[model samples]
Target: MIRSVVFDIGETLTSDTRYWADWARWLAIPTHTMSALVGAVVAQGRDNADAIRLIKPGCDVAAEWHARRTAGQDEYLDETDLYPDVRPALQRLRDAGLWVGVAGNQNHRVGDLLRGMKLPADAIGTSSEWGLAKPDRRFFDRVAEWAPGERHEIVYVGDHPANDITPGRAAGLRTAHLRRGPLGHLWADSPAVAAADWRAISLHDLADQLTSRPGGAVPAPSM
Candidate 1:
């Protein structure tokens, strides 16, 4: 029985098209160039941020983020950036008597933006706010802390298996591989992703499945 559902931010609840495009603009490169670089890095199992470094070696991506913010072009997300199913999916989960939370590998500013949207969330958290980021055991531990029931009763949903499904399982929570984003689509059929408790094409699919299985302990995907 799933008692809570915690969602990842980028590519899960919202898209990252604007983010990489902004970086391309700031670096004076074509958006397609940056997009290709991001795909290349991900294909090599490297961090997506490596695309930025691939453009300008030894570049401090963090510093660049600060620079963008100082220029009044900081990271942000509004309704337009969110997926069409996000609002209704979250609301559906909440209506099913499950706790719904939003947390991800994002900074506090992004967290603030999510909260400001007044989405149907019980709580919203971010990596910067938690002082931890995903793929780290401690980060999933922090995410698990938001649940109202046992770890197994909490389903951690995200697009990336390494940061989400893998670490989420290690943290003793159920894992849901949300297949939509770059990493999500590219690795959707991988063995790692196949190990998640659930694989969802959309939040609506997830909400329907989980809610229907309440108190029944829907089994995890076969290895």
Candidate 2:
């Protein structure tokens, strides 16, 4: 029986466009150029953090973040940053008595950020707190711990094929590939996503999957 649904935060349940655009502004890179660089980073199997240094060598990201915070310009997510499908999908699952959570590779402040935004997640955490990043089997092991279920009883939804789908599937949880983030859009047609237990254009499709199968039975793997 599927007992829990855990979603990736950036670009899965919420859009990080504004935050990335802010980084672009701070770096003085054209918005479109930043977007392209992000795609390139993903293609190279690196996280977005690499883009900051790649664009400007020796740029201290932590220092820049502190400066932004000091200037009252820290990038923070609000309700508006959430995807349109997030609330309804979460509500639907919760209404059906399923536990929901938001977990991803992010800074330690993510819990506070989600709380301030009032996202309806039963649990939330970031790599800073979890001590592991996605695509790492240990990370999904931790997620399994959080949900307190057999691996098959949990669903992990995220936009990154390599980061979200691959490891989650390997860890024995059902996986859903959501096409939303830059990596998501870039890899939408990739075989990694094609092999996911579910391929969804939005979270609503995930809700449909949950409600379509009752008694914790997972729907058949489908695109």
Candidate 3:
């Protein structure tokens, strides 16, 4: 039985449109350009840092983030940044006696953002504090530490097939590939994505499945 559900931050539980738009505004580029660049990167299964580097050759991601912080931007998520389905889905999971947490390749500010938003999460971990990012087995391993039982007792929900689902499955956790983020529409037919234990268009679908299932153990998706 799944005892914990850990989620990815960007494009998974939160809609990052405003966040990315902030970055674009700071960089003096059109927001649509940045949005398209992000989608392109996701479609190619590339990293966001790598995409940023490509946009501004020789740029430093950490330095850019620090600059944004200094400028009083990129601080936290606004109320409009979160997806409509996130709160209700998380609540439903908690009501079903399951642990809900957030784990992702996000900066330290994300923890503050989720907390400020008053999310009903048991724990929130980010790459900045964890010193590891997704697709790295260590990240998933860290999440396993917070779960009740063995690694398989947890389910990882996220949008990236390569970064989220692939490594998660390798770490012995069931995976849910969400079709809402950058990789959703473009990579839907990819072989890696097809292997996920579940494919959901929204968190609500997963919530419904867990609530209906005995012991909150999500069943395999019908082929």
Candidate 4:
């Protein structure tokens, strides 16, 4: 049975479109233009550090954009919204005796976001704090370590296959792909055998999947 359920933040529990768009607009560039710029950076075939170099110049651009969007508004950015079903789903998992946690490629500011959303503080993991990002074995290994008994009775649910599902599977955890968009193909190649939607499957479905098969690593799927 699944003892824990880990969630990815962006594109899973929360939407980041406004934040990014506002950032782009602040740079006096069109939203799509900024996206294309970032895409080009990624296409350069560089490591994360190199990619950061290409994008870091835009940090000031992002901050200025956000400043304009939030000027005289509120202390916290209101651009982020929790997915409609997210709070309920997390409650369902917690009520069903599962430890609900968050794992995401976020920085320390994730704590502020969680607090703003009234989410539990203890159930979060950010790359900034952990010094690791998703798809890295160390990220999953840390989650495994934090769980009771260092066992793999866990299920990680997220929208991104490359960032969330792949690493969860690699670390020997069951995975659930939240097919929120067109990226379902990404998870199709993961060790996870199931994908679900808010309308089609509940947290109970994930728990059921884990209960049926515990502790054995499934073969990687063809991505």
* Most TM-score-accurate candidate: 1
Model 4 scores what on Cα lDDT?
0.58
Please write out the lDDT profile of model 3 over residues 1-223, one tens digit for every residue: 7788889998898887887778788788888888888877766667766657767989998899889888877656867888998888999999999889898988777877787788878888898889998789989888888776678778898888888989999998888888886676567667877887777777888887766762444544533
How well is each residue in 1-223 modelled by candidate 2, as lDDT tens digits? 6788899888887787888799899888898888888778878888687888888888788898999889888768877888888888898998988899889988877667886776777888888798898778999999999985788889999988888998899898988888787788888888888777777777887788777873343443343
Best-fitting candidate, scored by lDDT: 1
lDDT of each: 0.88, 0.82, 0.81, 0.58
lDDT of 4 by residue, 1-223 (tens): 4577777777677765565565455446778765665455434533322323345554453454356546742223333366666766677656666677887887676646675666632477788888988778898888787654344577677766666666677777666776553244333443443422211133344444444443443332223
* 2 versus 4: better TM-score goes to: 2
RMSD of 3: 2.3
In model 4, what lDDT does residue 89 have? 65
- Alpha-carbon lDDT of model 3: 0.81
Clash pairs, model 1 backbone: none
Q: Is 3 or 4 the stronger prediction by lDDT?
A: 3
Candidate 3 residues lying further than 4 Å off, grouped into runs, are: 214-223
- The positional error of residue 218 in candidate 4, measured at the CA in angstroms, is 14
Stretch of 10 with least lDDT, candidate 3: 214-223
Model 2 TM-score is 0.89
